[model samples]
Target chain A: MKKLILSTAALALVAGFASADVVRMGTEGAYAPWNFVNDAGEIDGFERELGDELCKRANLTCEWVKNDWDSIIPNLVSGNYDTIIAGMSVTAERDEVIDFTQAYTPPDPSAFAALDAGLDVEGGVIAAQAATIQAAFIAEKGWTLIEFATPEETVAAVRNGEADAVLADKSFLDTVVGSDGLVLLERTEMIGGGVGMGVRESDQELRATFDAAIQSMKDDGTLNTLIAKWEVSSQW
Target chain B: MFSYCTDPEALEGLAWLSCYLTTGKHMGLYISVVTVLVLLAITAPVALAFGFAGATAARSKFLPLRWLGKGYTSIVRGVPDIAFFMFFVIALDQGFEWLRHQVKCPDWPDAIRQGNDFVVCTAAKLPLSASPQWLHETYAFFLAVLTFAIVFGAFAANVLFGAMRAVPRPQLETAEAYGMTRRQTFWRILVPQMWVYALPGLSNLWMVLIKATPLLFLLGVEDIVYWARELGGTKNARFTDYPHGDWRMWYFFALLVFYLSFTKVSEVVLERIMKRLTHGQATSGGEAQRRANA
Candidate 1:
């Protein structure tokens, strides 16, 4: 038992001093702008490319894996993935369990889209998934809110004109909202907390490297171009 | 420190209630219940009907037709049911368009099934592109119902065909001797007498059908499973009037109760049916009935 404990302590000490090398990244392959697998079976999108760039800048070898939106976090917690580059909105609730890097993409809460062209939804209030700061923003705006199984359904409701608009992340709005005739109509008055690069709580060194990666990407003007690529129809 | 609870700190009565009810996902959770019932309600009858036809065809005098029915029942039974559910719907939808493609969009030259993708003209799209969200949902449900019916029907057919043959050949022959035609004897003797034997198999089929309702979520029906996940997902306290932690376990527990209640109700109905079917027949159930109540 003494030897086992000593070996474990030695391993921990080694891990602490060892350079950050290989990192496993998690992503929900559903959302288009963030990360989605295309017809050619290649993961393509802003998040996908950005993660590669971040790894390169951080001097780390990276591996990407697709997971369902629901299982993404549990898998991360279970040590399946070291980082999540999925457009995961960092909330205080999430921070309690897992730490996040500095904001890579600013919050732009979702806007409404409608089936009817002249539906006059400019000032109508809305609701998004509960527990989200978006829900609080909804109450502040005094809008009726609805939750759906997927963003696809929420957008479907807007397309069906069930609600005046959907409240969601700006990046989500960019990916989900269509241009046929629907429009954002309005943006929330205050900016909600933005999405950030996620890492396991113990991976502070990795998080620091990710923060540096973000700064490098921003300086190179590559981040702006990547944002432009994903932001097909920006809400903000 | 806040545990996974739907209701935490309360501000007021109505305010708390409103927050509790409108946590946003409640509506979808509620709708999923209807979707499951609707899928089951339609699919069960269609499956039963298809099973009846398939069983009859398997017993038919025509060699090729009998082989087709036999092949359908056996081949489907061997494969994973979910695969049939996934592939059959897409195949069936494309099959519908292929028929329509041959007639409607014949001039447009493109192979309908290209490798893994099936593409038809925009005009040939099932439930036309301009249809509403509810219509898309309905169309998807229609496809699911068809898929469930086709798959479950095959199983039911195998059960029913055995039950049909289990009816005494002597009884059928006696009916024929009485100057009754084959159709008349089938209805008057074979169909009536086959019930006692078929009841056991059919009751088992009914239980399976009830359990299979969860598969609707896999088909994108947004049923109870979808709602449970959506509503159960944790929301950050940073954004809501009434914030809570992950309550997915409780949501799943509620779903378990719903399914159990559904199963209990079906069991009662099937029991009642079994009693009714056993009345005044040559079988042991009928014989016991005569001795007990006579």
Candidate 2:
């Protein structure tokens, strides 16, 4: 048993180092259609497929690292990963911390999910995941905002009547709405710039590499294909 | 960071892993291990003091003091520790904010709990929204430690109360015969002799405390278990440098070893302390030592 374990460790270590010119991509695996852990316990969804194609086009060996959404950019900046492809939308506040490549997906509409279709979303208590654009939007509108750590909890808050509605990315809420008596409200808030790959400010060369790949993907319509297949944001 | 680590793409194998393991997030994991140790060190003593106070108060001559002490232990101990943790941190944070809100925003028109949202004035926010991330994390750690101390302190009190009572009544009578005051009997006699009885229970509590460190994650402290799950999930070539299939089993296995080794060390240390406490006392442990010495 000991020998078998040692041999496995040795093989894994050797296999791990075989790839040179590697790019580490960071994502939050909990967000579906954007990036999520599939039934096989492997990361799947729109960003995952797009990231893989981008890495292949860039001729860089890449690996995925799942990080919490709350710390995704910080982890990227601190060298835990080489890039953030975690469905993160471009924003001025985030730009101050790290650079973003050309957007792969267009600005996704933020929608409200509530128990009642006629719920007063504008003035009612709102739920959003902390540190998200939706959360910021709610706070900006001066609505009563209750924040949870994860997206699921935001939905749970609305279901349990802790909040009147949960505001989230339409791509995320599309699969969630219509179940558990959740109805999508009519009001849609288009917030944030298009979703893009995030890189550390110092990684200019890496950013340029990904930007070229993303541009190529956009020109050839492969990015739009993946976006449509995953039913994420509208085509570029 | 090593010299070759400057270009992560050029690195392979052990070199790649060396850099990967030394990343800032990994360093956070390493530091959080220290956080657990620090929590245990601080909490054990604080909880013991609380437990001592509680046990002593339960034996108090004053009626209200005794009731207060017993009530504290019963109420805290009756609720599940997880439920207590979830309730206490929010309650304590809101309690502090509410107090500050009353003082800071006395003229403010809005009620704090508007519907389900607990909105304290910006000035009254705990650690403030604009405070640095480390300050927020530190405040959370402080709350976690306080909650752990309160919960474990109650259990410790129960053990200590029984231990105090178990000290022979004749021993107190004998102290009285020697003209020792009630205070002196408790301090010089009852307190001193109770430990030989208490050490076994306290040692068990120590093990439980070590096991309970993982609960820090639930309180949003990002403890060792949190790091394990974060780092060990499946990573394909699409997202990170070190791509692997679901390696959570391995990461959790490493945690298992860490906890076992830690508990083993605690057991050895507790055994030594037990020996020291039992010395010359009229107990089975002291009798065993006397026979071995003879």
Interface RMSD of each: 24.2, 18.0
Tens-digit per-residue lDDT, B177-288, candidate 2:
9999999999999999999899889989999999999989766677898777656654434445455544667878999999999999999998899889889888887899
Q: After superposing candidate 2 on the true structure, give the runs of residues whose Cα lies further than 4 Å from its correct spot.
A: A1-232, B7-10
Q: Calculate DockQ per candidate and list them.
A: 0.02, 0.03
Worst 10 residues of 1 chain B by lDDT: B234-243
Least lDDT summed over 10 consecutive residues: which range in candidate 2 chain A?
A: A1-10
lDDT of 2 at A195: 88
For model 2, state the Cα shift of residue B103 in Å. Answer: 1.4
Across A56-175, the per-residue lDDT of candidate 2 in tens digits comes to 999887777666677666445434457888878899988887889988888878999999999888779999999988889899999999998767668767877899999998988886
Best by lDDT: 2
Kept native contacts, fraction for each prediction: 0.00, 0.00
Cα deviation of B169 in candidate 2 (Å)? Answer: 1.5
lDDT by residue for model 1 over B131-245, one digit each (tens)? 3334445656776777788788888888889989998788889989999998898789988888788878887887888788777755556677755754554433322335444
Q: Which residue pairs in candidate 2 have backbone atoms (N, alpha carbon, C) closer than 3 angstroms, thus clashing? A: A17-B13, A21-B9, A24-B240, A25-B239, A25-B240, A63-B239, A63-B240, A64-B239, A64-B240, A65-B239
